[model samples]
Target chain A: MLTKRIIPCLDVKEGRTVKGVNFENIRDAGDPVELGSFYAQQGADELVFLDITATNEKRKTLRELVSRVARHINIPFTVGGGISSVEDVVALLQNGADKISVNTSAFKSPQLINELAKEFGSQCVVLAIDTRQEADGNWYVYLNGGRVKTEADCFRWAKEGVDRGAGEILLTSMNHDGTKKGFAVDITLQLASLSVPVIASGGGGTMEHFTDVFRQGKADAALAASIFHYKEIGIPALKQYLQQQGIVVRWESNENFIC
Target chain B: MNIVIIKYNAGNVQSVLYALERMGIAATVTDDHEKIRSADKVIFPGVGEASTAMQYLRERKLDQVLKDLHRPVLGICLGMQLMCAYSEENNTACIGIFEEKVRHFSAAHADVGQPAGEEPLKVPQIGWNNIFHLKTPLFRGVHENSYIYLVHSYYAALGEHTIATAHYGLDFSAALHKENFYGVQFHPEKSAAAGAQVIRNFIELVPAI
Candidate 1:
């Protein structure tokens, strides 16, 4: 049976992982590559590197960080944030990024999804949709790191993205992102109707939240950041908990560290 | 050791290069005919549309080079698909190194994700799954049920050349071997320890040419 994946998200700034990540044993705690290695050692099924470094020099640092992380870890990882063109996707894929996530650019040009999926195959293209529930109780698309709102509805955009050749959907609820209350199972379950594997992101608070996203949300994978970074939850422990609860997951033990 | 990874328009070549770097072996990723043929060990790794990838190889005259390689050749993912005779993907004619055909998963088995007498058809069998019925030196140190990463919409039907089989919609060749030529549908480079073992085994298979 194919096990549900537990992915840890890392925010990279200026080529290093942001603050508050458990870094006791790492020689250079700031390095994103080092953090990737640590998570790989802890049995993270896959890792997501979000380059949030807001600078004119974002390209050089993020590319270097991806290269370093690629050289250090063997597991697959996705690079997201500020990816606007096919050139950017090519550059990142050349740097050893298994997949590239597109959000704002994808919305700006829906045809970009078809172009990318045509050139690189759908498996390599992930449509990262950032959605937030408004006062009308209907989820709306947000762009520019959740600052700009778009008229596109979440469900319709996700369906159109898939039809445009997106193999996976990384749906994140902005309202639930920093809250950590729980995954937006309502939206996730609705998004799953698209039939291309949905990666439920944002508001992954506890182990129960993960199981809920998998069982009720019907998410093929769950991605979280702060929970895994703050040491409040360890990947190995969470996977074990899911396993005990009859949720299929891949868990590599300490003695068999691949790194 | 001169490890040459055949580089063309195919995607995911960088991951293979980095995998070798981690193994402490500097590998040259190139499409040079002489470089690919002369290298002691050749790794043909690919990711992309089969027809487009094969078209790129044909234009580069690599079609003949890959077919005539005398040394140990390892093909991963789409590289394995191209080693076959034909692929349903874009109806492409391949190098015929494996004497098999690549095909998209059957959608006949509907009601895929429910508990029924039949299983739903899942294409591109992404993520990690275990490979069993192992044979050949490629899987020497790999455990029978150990998981490896795979991401493909087409698969080569089981044949005499099959070295390992993995299940999704149905059992297909996870790894296939015919003489010096080896093909793995899964990405050993991205498959962690068990996958590392497979790469290590392939590198150690020959007694220095």
Candidate 2:
């Protein structure tokens, strides 16, 4: 059976982890490689490193960080933030990134999705959609780190992205972000109706939120940042809890054997 | 052992190289016939569309080169799919090393009914899942129901050559072995500890030839 994925997201800036991680015994919390390997050791199904750096050397820094992370961590990881061209994706993949996420560039020129899907298979292309529900009770797509809003409907744009050859959708609800209340079940459920797998992001406060997203929202995966970074919820315990709830997750007992 | 990873137009092979390096083994990535034929072990790693990859191999004559090699050759993901006789993806003919046909998961799921209220199986399964019924030296130390990562929309049908199986909507070949050739549908390179063990087992296998 294909199990629901639990992912730990890291925000990287200038080749270092941006958010303060609370993992004990970690020599350098700023080191993405060490932190990524630590998360893999904790049985994180996958990792997503979002490069939040805005500089001329951002690409070089990310490439170095990606290769360093790949050399240490064995599980698959995705790299995102400011990835617009095929060359950028090529550099990252060549350095060992399993997948790449695109947002603003993809929205500005939707053809970029087709080009990436053509060059590399669709499986490696992840469409990251940032959206927010407005006064009209409709979700609108937002871009540039949720600062700019577009007239495009979230559901329609998601469907269009899928049709254009995005294999997965990372839907982050701006409304629910940092609220720690719960996932945006309504919009997530709608996006999950599409043929592609939907990764529900933002508003994950507790393990029950994960259960609700998987059971009710029908999300194929759930991604959270602070909850994991601050050690508020350990992945092993969360997996056990979800397992007890009858949700199938990839839980292995051989923690000591992880290489 | 001199290991060579057969490189083509397929997706990145750097992860595979990095995985082997973790095992303290350095491998060369090349397409030269002599290098692949002369190596003690050869790994064919791929991550791309079937027909296009097969076309590249055919054009480069790597298909024939691969078939003629007697050394232990292991294929991963699309590399495994291309070892089959035919693929439903883009209606392409494969290398015919394995008699089974590569099939799209959706077409295979049609006969199997989904449990009530369950979400339809997503295409291109993109996460960790367990592999069971291990029967090959490739999985010698790996336990039954060991989880491995996978990402694909198509799968190779279970057949006589199947050494292991996994279930998505139905049971399909997780690993296949025949004589000197071996193939696995999952990306062992990206599958963490258990995956590293599988790669180690393959490296330690005694070539039947």
True contacts kept of each: 0.56, 0.79
lDDT of 1 by residue, A1-259 (tens): 5778888888776666663212112222256777788888787888898775432233432676788888888899898888877888888988889998888878989999999998889999999988989999999998766667898899999999999999899988887885678999999999877757889988887889999999999888999877777777899899999988998787645334233
Clashing pairs in 1: B112-B120, B124-B152
Ten-residue stretch with the least lDDT total in model 1 chain A: A20-29
Please, what are the lDDT tens digits per residue for candidate 1 over residues B1-209? 88998888885788888888888888898889888888999999988999899988999899899999889999999999999999989899999999878888754223234446633434556788878999977777666777788888888989999999988866788988888899999998988888888888889874433
lDDT of each: 0.82, 0.88
Q: Pick the DockQ winner.
A: 2
Error of 1 at A72 (Å): 1.0
Using lDDT, give the best candidate's number: 2
Task: In angstroms, give how far residue B55 of model 2 lies from its true place.
Answer: 1.2
Error of 1 at B142 (Å): 1.5
DockQ-based class of model 2:
medium
Please estimate how well model 1 matches the true structure, expressed as its whole-model Cα lDDT.
0.82
